[model samples]
Target: MSIEREDLMICPARVTLDAAQMAFFDGLPTKAPSVQAELGCELEQGHEGSHAALGQQVDTTMWWIQWTLSASEINPYTWCPATHLPDTERRDDKDCALFNGHPGSHSSAKRSWQASEAA
Candidate 1:
């Protein structure tokens, strides 16, 4: 049976990297062509800083990467392989959203809802 777009749910997958893995990722070529080809999606990476309060332990900086998943890669019955990091452990799933419509596309449902509210 075919599944509709709105019926699908997306979630994020995390990969915690060690020192060596982090170095390898940092040394990757600009634009990360090889990594992108392997993952089948565009990627954007950045460093996320952490803050601590008094008497609390300071959090270490981590490399944060986000990517978009292809339609075929999404599986409602199982967890989708969102990101494939080199030699890292998996973590809990994070909430994700999927937008099917293209930019500037008209939304008939939105219009209908507006009309109903006006009545």
Candidate 2:
């Protein structure tokens, strides 16, 4: 089964899943009675599947994407920039992005996060 590349999480890191691995990911269900479809993360530096649960849960601590990346060729780690004020000089209190109270960091002090490594 070939999954749409656009449907993947919008992360810069390499999605190194091979055909077989992709087949496995494609075959897995995104939702269950308790689990919901994990939407792709839009944050510039957020980790893949950070915005949603992309894969089924393998256990209490990890999900299927995590399992797949363990063997795939990706960066050593994924550290996304917390949401920051687009203009830190002014009194702008709103986040640069529309999302608020999201996961990861949202500290007003942070002006930006790590520079993107790849497209």
Q: How many residue pairs clash (N, CA or C atoms closer than 3 angstroms) in each of the candidate models, in the order given?
A: 0, 1
lDDT of 2 by residue, 1-59 (tens): 87544334334443334566456545545332232233233333464343322233222
Q: Supply the global lDDT for candidate 2.
A: 0.33
Clashes of 1: 0
* Candidate 1's TM-score: 0.20
Instruction: Give the poorly placed runs of model 2, Cα more than 4 Å off.
Output: 1-11, 29-64, 67-70, 73-103, 106-119
The CA root-mean-square deviation of candidate 1, after full C-alpha superposition on the true structure, stands at 19.9
Model 1 segments beyond 4 Å from truth? Answer: 1-8, 31-119
lDDT per residue as tens, model 1, 4-24: 443232122233334543455
Give the number of the best model, judged by lDDT: 2
In order, the Cα lDDT scores of the candidates are 0.25, 0.33
Q: What is the C-alpha RMSD of each candidate to the true structure, in Å?
A: 19.9, 13.6
